[model samples]
Target: MSAKTKNKHDQSESPRLGASAFSARSKRVTVNMGDGQKVKTLTPKQRGATTEQKSVAKDVKKVMAKCKEEHDMRLDLSRCEVTELPRYIKELSHLEEMYLYGNRLTTLPPEISSLLNLKILALSENMLSSLPDEAESLLCLKVLDLRHNRLKEVPFVVYQLRSLQTLFLRFNRVTSLTPEIKNLTQLTTLSMRENKFKELPEEIGYLRCLSVLDVAHNHLEHLPHSIGNCNQLVTLDVQHNELVDLPETIGCLTCLKRLGIRYNRIREIPAELEKCSDLEEFNIEQNKLKTLPEGLLKRFKNCSSLQLARNQFEEFPSGPPAQFGPLTSFSIEHNKVTIVPFGVFSEAKKLTKVHLKDNLISSLPLDFGSWVQITELNLASNQISKLPDDIKHLTKLEVLILSNNVIKLLPKSIGGLCNLIHLDLEGNRLESLPAEIGYLTSLTKLSVQSNRLTVLPRGIGHLVNLKHFSAGENNLTQLPEEMGTLESLEELYLNDNPNLQMLPFELALCRKLALMSIEGCPLGRLPPQVVDGGPSAIIMYLRTQGPYRAMSFS
Candidate 1:
């Protein structure tokens, strides 16, 4: 045949092979070249362009082949960028666990139900908006993690998964669950946090086996009364919601260990909650509560952590629980509390941390010395005028924040805080720091700025470990010569001290002092070394200008 007619004939006779045509047995096929000559040819290249989809298709085939040969029960295609699953996936009927998380898939295929033995399915962090109705056939599915998806509602097929023990739908768009959810008789965990749920269905009580139920960050207004039926619940967190009150039946959850209802509109806690004797952690802060339910504190025999901040209480919960337990941390800041009721904390000797800032209290009860185990005490922004001499009992305290108070003097006993590392007395009415302040050998930061101080105690030089010192905005005429002993000093701020006329030449001994601020001082003319240099240079000039005198602060 002529070349043109031969080419046309070959083109029209070219065999179009399907994907199956490339089987091992047909790797090579005989074809008529249409030129009166027969030629042997290998399998043709794949029909589509080489792209990510093509590679993924090959991966799916390989995985299926391997699983089919080994009869593997688990398959993980997580983060594989898979958008569409092949219908042949059903061939792996033995698969008991399947993870396709972090993929681009928007929907699952109905054929997925063919895996009747599947007990765990994780499709989290995907774009899935729905599951096929046929998924109800997965009767053995025990765990379903569909978090970080776009599902606007619970898939109806999910309720049919009678054996499901854990269902995580967090970070989804789901607004409500159907009453059919009660069908999950074996469900133990149900987390739907960060959704738009207004209220849970009353049928939720049917989940008697549920141990953890977290629906935080939703728009829930009230919990259904039937919730009390889940006596097995150990954790119930509804934080960041609009809940007006908890169901009185919550007291039925005797097994509850952690209950968080923060950031809600609840005005009063149900007295029935005191029945949860096993409760250990209770957080009800940022609410409209003015007083706790009577006998609430005494009932929490095992409670160790209590947070009652941002409330409207006028007095401390006095009459300390007659039989308090191992209370370790107590925070009641941003309240109207005036009387601290020292007797309340006297019973809890194991307390380690206390946050009583931003209150109206003018004085701390002398019983504060009883908390020997306390390590951090933040009593800032209160109306306190003087610290009890018993403050020396807090020898283990590491941080003491007493700023924005009207204290005129610090007790000499304050030096008893040997382990104190941070002491902030800023915005105080202090006229002077106690000479005993030098006893804090471990002190690293000390700020007495905006105070009524005339001079720093010579003992200040003993803070060998001090790295930052701020004594600005005071009536200081000069720094103590002992300050030169701060070998670890790195930053010093002495601005706005108008009466300050000169700095101690001993400051030159602070070899590590890199930053120094002495603005608003009326120091007269100085040599080049002192006028245009850092702390070290200025101190050096003073050392040469003034008579050298050896002094000992100790």
Candidate 2:
């Protein structure tokens, strides 16, 4: 399947109850940055405009005149490349919102504090290393965006903003937060990703209204136990940190919904997390976990996606099927699991995606077919040798990747997957494909490379939508003349099939055939020039010499 189509399918099936869904700052941002709220930047009138005083003065003059004439409450001077604000900016005291992002300002004029009614001030992407003392006078200010700056610490004036609700300091040089941060009791969203913080002050728990707190991509070794005091938190992302484990107080966050702790050095999950009943998305992919805490899965009744790839898990976590009641996507790839216990996933009737690739799985349980709603199933690089006939029940399966497996035979029931678009059977021991494969009319990409097949089923010609077909490194000789019916064929791989000695003349019917590989094959009847000239030249030779009328390439 094409990546666009696959992504569309994935998006439609996954639930959207994560942090981005709950944070107001994230929704208001014009440019999205992963799972965290970002600076709301605007496009400049001219790309890469310089910080010329004349241009800045002209733009500021026009904006000031408009505010004076219409009593406008919003002033937009963003991306103007201004180095300093005019001292007369104090005259715009009625302004309620101000945008000055993407500028060269290293300091703000004391006159900026004159906007006593200002609610939002965007200063992201600036050269400022600190805020002016007068900034504390903006008593009505609520949102302050200072991302992408050179600040080495949270400005002292920031702690004085009693009305502030959201604070963005991403991509800064800040190494620590003052205990005074507890002064912002109204702060709901605090995004400090990509910073140099080694630890957070325990005073963060003072914000009872805090909802979205993202501290990802930092050097923090542990989370302050005070984090549990913020009961209103919906999204807490601490991924890419050096934390060894979570504080037991985490269980007190009953309102928590999405917890992202991937790419960390955590060795075990604190059982306290089971108390967060609202949890839906739990990502712990690259941790050092060896086992799931007892009854942890059973308590997360709302979990829709669980990712534990690259962990030290040795077997499927032991639990009742009820733990998977709401699961739609699950991945445990790169583990040492040898088998999937029966009925483990039987209760997950809504399961649509599963990834168990690169494991030691030898055989899928017979109940695998129960996941009739599954769309994408990847079991590549495993030791499986055969598939159950019950696979026919997965009529909605689209992408099936079983590459590098020891499978020798495919059940004829596979043809029932009428929705399958990409089938990767590369590096398998298959001797032949079933004729029922012709029933897969939706297939666009098929791979049977490095197999022991001597001849393709005549059904190969029925795949009118097939674009990429790989049958190289096989035991094949001549291809079926029916291949001429593949009107959409674009690339064909027939390299390393030493038994192939002749070309099928009917192949000239595929007008769209642009790339064909017959390397490592001994076709003694054809001249070396014709073989070296590629598909276009070979097609021309077959048309003129064999029984077809000559046609001009033009």
Q: Give the top-scoring candidate (lDDT).
A: 2
Q: Poorest 10 consecutive residues of model 2 by lDDT?
A: 20-29
Go through the candidates in order and give each one's C-alpha lDDT. Answer: 0.83, 0.85
Candidate 1 error regions (>4 Å): 1-50, 321-323, 498-554
True-structure RMSD, every candidate? 14.0, 9.1
- lDDT per residue as tens, model 2, 239-326: 9888888999999999999998999999988889889989999889998998988789889888999898989888988788888879
Per model, state how many residue pairs clash.
0, 0
Which tens-of-lDDT digit does each residue in 33-70 have in candidate 1? 88877674644233233344566668777877787799
Best by TM-score: 2
- TM-score (all chains, Cα) for each model: 0.84, 0.87
List where candidate 2 sits over 4 angstroms from the true fold. Answer: 1-53, 517-524, 539-554
